[model samples]
Target: MEIPQANLGRGINLGNALEAPQEGEWGIVIQEYFFDKIKDVGFKAVRIPIRWSAHTETHFPYTINESFFQRVDDVINQALAGNLNVIINIHHFDELTEDPLQHEDKLYQIWRQITERYSGFPDQLIFELLNEPHEALTSDLWNQFIINLLEIIREANPERSVIIGPVQWNSISGLDSLALPQDQNLIVTFHFYSPFQFTHQGAEWVEGSDSWLGTTWEGTESEMSAITNDLDKAVRWAARNEIPLFMGEFGAYYKADYESRIRWTRFLAREAEKRDISWAYWEFGAGFGIYDIENDEWDMGLLNALIPHVLVFDKDASPQSQSR
Candidate 1:
């Protein structure tokens, strides 16, 4: 079977998907009408990042509640109906958030359930192993544990594409340490917040990022070169292993200036094309605002700046790209 590919991370992280409405209070179902707008905005896929463990029976060992699975499935189907591929994964399912290894049995069972539940979903629905494992795990520890997880996933999902990232909260550079399982049905995944000086400038979540305040994303030739060089390294690694490389996440924080953010993304798109890698931006709305919800329209000025670099067609169909 041919492995599936995502056009770009021009996808939404379904954060508002699950909520038990209280006393007539309303919450979005993820499958709501908004996706037509998201899909129309040129997104090729949607990553339904579910935080299900909170609603699950902890004692069941990776056994997810049926209601949650059904809800997730409904959303997944919605994206598919909109002609978009789907990426589903365990996002923050690791309760400890620090030591996933300590819960090996639970982790294995979690993946087993996910693999079985989505076994019938076709190529378009991809599985990301985890959403950025944290807690200062050593390289050896992560490698061995991931290899085992890959073994389990492959047992049930031999042809379904799987994604794996390194232990440093899915840092791109740390990705060098990942050794994919012997199974060929997997892709190495990593997140990009490069020039953290530029991308994560004023993210309230990041401490010591005060320096990036009031600064526009200064995407220089050097920074662009470094990014592509790093991505090229990943591509080469994949080629050696005969697997695909997926830059699963990259987005500038909302603090960056409008035009600068567009410039930065254009550079990212160009660089990804140059390296023969596929990517997904951090999101379609909120924080990244690929779509400005308040206006109910794209930041056209931003999208226009990026149009020349955005990949409207598959790389193979792309015209000869001149160097940046």
Candidate 2:
């Protein structure tokens, strides 16, 4: 059967917000202007990483907090109002990752509530089962979990598009181990941070990352080939499986050299587009931010790389100043 492609062209992840234990805990509150800005800047979609496990009951039934649902609803509505596609998923469920056997039921109930809540939403909304399944959750177990979760979601939303990815933090090599049911509505996703030493240099949570701080991507033939080769693996897998692919996340941390970041970002964006794959840059207004919230302006160099045709100007300059 042929599966239709999801048109998630030039998207950005609303990371470090709801995925954090709290909304503002990571210094992002998902303001209305954020969605408006991205929409105006040419982003067609927004992938929201939500930590539902943090807000649900630890026991059976696993009721989610009503207030939290409203908070998420508001964020989704804001994006929809701006005519942007939205993708929400289970994120940062550390307990489940550490002990999948013990928390299996909890994970099921979490998706049960999420699917029921959003079943009535428009088709513009997408559900990504979980983000970066790893740790104690082996490939076999993760594959089983996908089957179980899809059954639950199907009860409420039979045809809604849902995204699933391979284990090992959604690595490209992990694609060979991924097994999926014969569902045309499913899209395969993978994250790219190849040459992690360069992408994650100085990232606080990554231990020993400080030592990689000065690393840079110069877009040399070898460097470019490395990325192209990695992405090609995904392209081949999707072709064989007859599934559409989405590069769910890819970006360099702010600690990297500014010019190196732009070159890397532009190169990857173009490569993914060339392969007919859609992508969402790892984040917005945080460690890998392209927008500067403090100054209410964009990092135009990085932004232009992601969306090459957007009009660029010095936000600080007045019309008269430019004319003079």
Candidate 3:
């Protein structure tokens, strides 16, 4: 099955913003202008990480608040209008990780409502099953959940390309444990943050991140080799399984040195593109963001490194100013 452009393009995640416990709580707001800005910066896709659990009723049927769903709908509509491939997923469902069995039914109920709501959307919209399943959610248990949830999604929208990642925080090695279903309309995904000490250095959210503040990705041969080896494993697995692979997230946190961050970012982007793997960077604006929402501008150095062909955003002018 050929991977559609909607599922196989350079993309960026609208992270922390919507995925936070509360929208805008993380300091980034979803605005209609933001979608246009993303398209203007040459991204072909956008991944919106949404926390549906927070807004939904915690009972049978798991009713998603109409207002919350409408807000997401508006965001999706904006992205579509800008001709961007959009991915929406269940993010930050901490309860599920804490007690998978306890929340299994609720998870199913949420998906039932989501799939039904987006049932009539165009193919440009993709559904990602869940984000970084970890902790109590073992691979075996997650695999079972995936099979069941996919069945529910397929029942509502059989042709929609659904993305599923391995357990253990979507680590590359974790791919070994994922048991993909026999559905061709599926894309396997995994996140890349190898040598985490460098990428996540000083990221307050990670334990002991402060201690790794000085770490840097100098792009040593050994470092490059490790990256290639990790990616090679995923490529081989995807080819063997005859499923397209997507690097759903990858980026160095802001604490890393600018030059080192660029080097790592460019390397990963190029390597993934070399192997024909689709990817979306970790975020738009916040933490691993490439854009600075407060300034309403892109980090041209980062942008240039990730998408070399696109013209750099001219900082001297308005945020919308651009020239090839």
Best by lDDT: 2
Task: Enumerate residue pairs that collide in model 1.
Answer: 9-279, 9-280, 9-281
Write the residue-wise lDDT of candidate 1 on 1-324 in tens digits: 122343444555544344222111223345365567666546666776666655556674657778767777777788778877788776765554566556666777877888878788878888887778777465677787788877787787788877778878887667777765676567777788777778888777689787777676667777668877777766666666666667777778878776778778888766775665676666655666465555555555455443444322223655333213
For each candidate, give its TM-score against the true structure: 0.83, 0.95, 0.95
Per-residue lDDT of model 2, residues 1-324, tens digit only: 223366878899999999999899999888998998899879999999999999997789999999999999999999999999899999999998999999999999999998999999998899999899998999999999999999999999999999998899999999999999988699889999978999999999999999999999999999999999998888888888988989999999999999999999999999999888999998899999988888887787888889986763555543211110
Alpha-carbon RMSD, each predicted model: 6.3, 2.8, 2.5
lDDT of 2: 0.90
Off by over 4 Å in 2: 1-4, 312-324
* Decreasing lDDT order of the candidates: 2, 3, 1
- Residue lDDT tens for model 3, 1-324: 233232468999999877888897888889899888888868898999999899888788789999999999999999999999999999999999999999999899999999999999999999999999999999999999998999899998998999999999988889889998798788889999988999999988899999998888899999999999998898888877788888999999999998999999999999888888899999888889888878767887788777885664455654443322
For candidate 2, the per-residue lDDT at 69 reads 93
Candidate 1 at 60: error in angstroms?
3.2
Highest-TM-score candidate: 2
Residue 162 of model 1, lDDT score: 75
**Model 1 scores what on Cα lDDT?**
0.67
The order by descending TM-score is 2, 3, 1
Model 1: lowest-lDDT 10 consecutive positions: 19-28
Better of 1 and 2 by lDDT: 2
